[model samples]
Target: MRRLRPVRGKERRKKPIHDGCFEIRNPARLLVVAPRVPCPVKSEHISDAVASVIGPDFTIAFQPIVDLELREVFAHEALVRGLHGEGAYEVLGKVQAHHRFAFHEACRVKSIEMASMLGMRSRLSLNVAPNDIAGPAECFHTAIRTAERVGFPVDRLMFELTEGEPVADLPALAATFRSFQRFGFTSAIDDFGAAYAGFELLAAFQPDVVKLDVSFVRDIHLSAVRFTIVKGFVAICDELRIQVIAEGVEAPEEVDVLRRLGVRLFQGFLFARPGTAVLPEVAWDAA
Candidate 1:
């Protein structure tokens, strides 16, 4: 008996969504976004969807997740929305409280389709549980295939893997990471400081990118301790050459500190609000 090489890189059937390459014949199952709200999309996803909240603009903004130099962040995190209803975060509490986990998947799938359709030259950062990665490989494969069909670069797209959910087996985890990598999709360890993995994930998984949790970024100026803490990570990241994208950027003072400290890459309300244009009119400089 022989074991598989994890994944044998096979050309499975594709439901191209764009041109001859993009397809989404079988989209993923989203469980949160309510179709009752107006969504600027049309698909065979749910039995019936209301209208699209997105206007005729057909634009999904990508706030730059950039270095301290103030460069534009090309990697836009895929945000979840509930069409014309309230924002996703508010609805999150409601859904979680009501235990509407089933609807959540349906919502997520719709969001992905909308974002992918609007993607252009930037990576759409989609939040995913570590469990999702370990779950049925078919789903993830579907995501990659869908991206290809939608004319989005799978390699450029970063799956923002939030911390939590213990890895039952280290080997299995590594194998999964490799599978996504092989598909040209990169993984990011979101909220790096919040997780205990810290250096462990860096050494084990060697993620392509690491997002500095927003907590440290919030009150960075008044706290020198935060500077020391973030500086240390920046030093290691510089050595590894792995880009450090700081989330939750708000104040010019905080950006000043992060820039001086040698930590590059930032994303937060200061730069541009989520759902706004990718690069705002703000005169932020990478220098």
Candidate 2:
């Protein structure tokens, strides 16, 4: 994983694009593809072994990325998919109806397990609901321990707080985060733009990093409103000296604009697509 650092103005690099897809293995030790949208697949023989709890309905698939610089799989963000003809928003409701928090937690653990099997261990950025931060420390202890057992760097893993829910108690949240810090694990508040910006959390919690939501970067050059918002974000980060990352940068123009605004760190298709399909996407892009 590359630490965020200041960059002198230079040409933005845009080279790769990612078509996202993932294979999911259920707890039952069965393999299934988390379809982009809900689609009917032949399940005749499959029903004999175990009935489907999570049918072929729309569920999210997670894409794991390998950081080329470290030659390791740093983290995997959970991406949602819709049901047969259902949009992500609809599927989200279904997931919540089930065990949304538990599902993501399991997915992160599973993804990390897969990464570790492949000897990829830079960090794991697990997307999670904001409210679930209320869980007991035991909730995350297993993940930390698992990473350790697998020889993964505990400090390098990033637990992404992806929820937009307001931080009800900043001190309490910080206390929870401190536990991770004590164990040498770092944290990041992901999707900062779409969610309500938690300046208090950002300032007080002092997370290791903050991920600028991709929405803020999409076609940013054309959107004055987004540019102002990003500029303001960059300004605040500058003051706090906190690291900020621009996500979903797909065009050279976007990179150029962000560079001019003093945004040093960025991630998107313009740089490399997700998946271990090809390693060192970032390193090769720069070199």
Candidate 3:
């Protein structure tokens, strides 16, 4: 099984929000910029030689996870962006197998630093690989310290595990999640329906949230088959007591169908594109 990779990246070149503190429409999610554009390259120690091997310069862009019934921002998923605003794969592609550990650590701490600097009050979600975090406490030393340094509570952070990486050892992965939970950090399974992550892992690990893949949510209103599948999936999650967040929701009709099927949480370009400095302004058509 290929190791699951880390993701969630973007950037903005804008003014600081009101003297280094800015408020989004949802006060819970704040985006603070310095007097000039703050550099996202907080991990200067990673070294240019090592970084050249890993790929281009790195930064972060945040995309909002929204709650429709409450009509407020629920959380921000931090994505990795290259200096030229390349996507996660572009940044990640440069990393070789041996450097993954360092790359993952760099991205995690960088996300925390930027989020904390921006005063993100909502839950901040960072992508992590099961392979990289099988021993959570030992692996999380940098993250924990960075959180404390930035005054961001561990509980306010959520680690996202994309299903793209299949787990080689279920028990070990579950233990890792347990370790993280013990430390007050939350967890979620990203791109849940897009891959082979299914009942076996769900029964074993039981993440706090399952992000429904965009394939399921895209044009859902147009497909009765999709509607039925997602509808049933929602029921299963309700019974299991796991929260479901629909991802890649781009149309108003998609939101309507998802709401009818009982998915309250959502993320997609319809609300806002991932932004570098501030939370993208949500149009609030669903509200």
* Best candidate (score: lDDT): 3
Quote the positional error of residue 195 for candidate 3 in Å: 2.3
* Top candidate (TM-score): 3
Per-residue lDDT for 200-271 in model 1, tens only? 666777666778888888888889899889898888877775667778887888888887877666788776
In model 2, the worst 10-residue window by lDDT is 21-30
lDDT score, candidate 2: 0.54
TM-score leaderboard ranking? 3, 1, 2
Clashing pairs in 2: 38-84, 74-123
Residue 88, candidate 1: alpha-carbon lDDT: 53
**Would you give me the overall lDDT of model 3?**
0.72
Please identify model 3 stretches exceeding 4 Å from their true place. 1-56
- For all predicted structures, in order, the TM-scores are 0.69, 0.65, 0.82
Q: For candidate 3, what is the TM-score?
A: 0.82
Off by over 4 Å in 1: 1-63, 67-70, 84-87, 94-108, 164-170, 195-197, 276-287
Quote model 1's TM-score: 0.69
* TM-score: the better of candidates 1 and 2: 1
Error of 2 at 145 (Å): 2.5
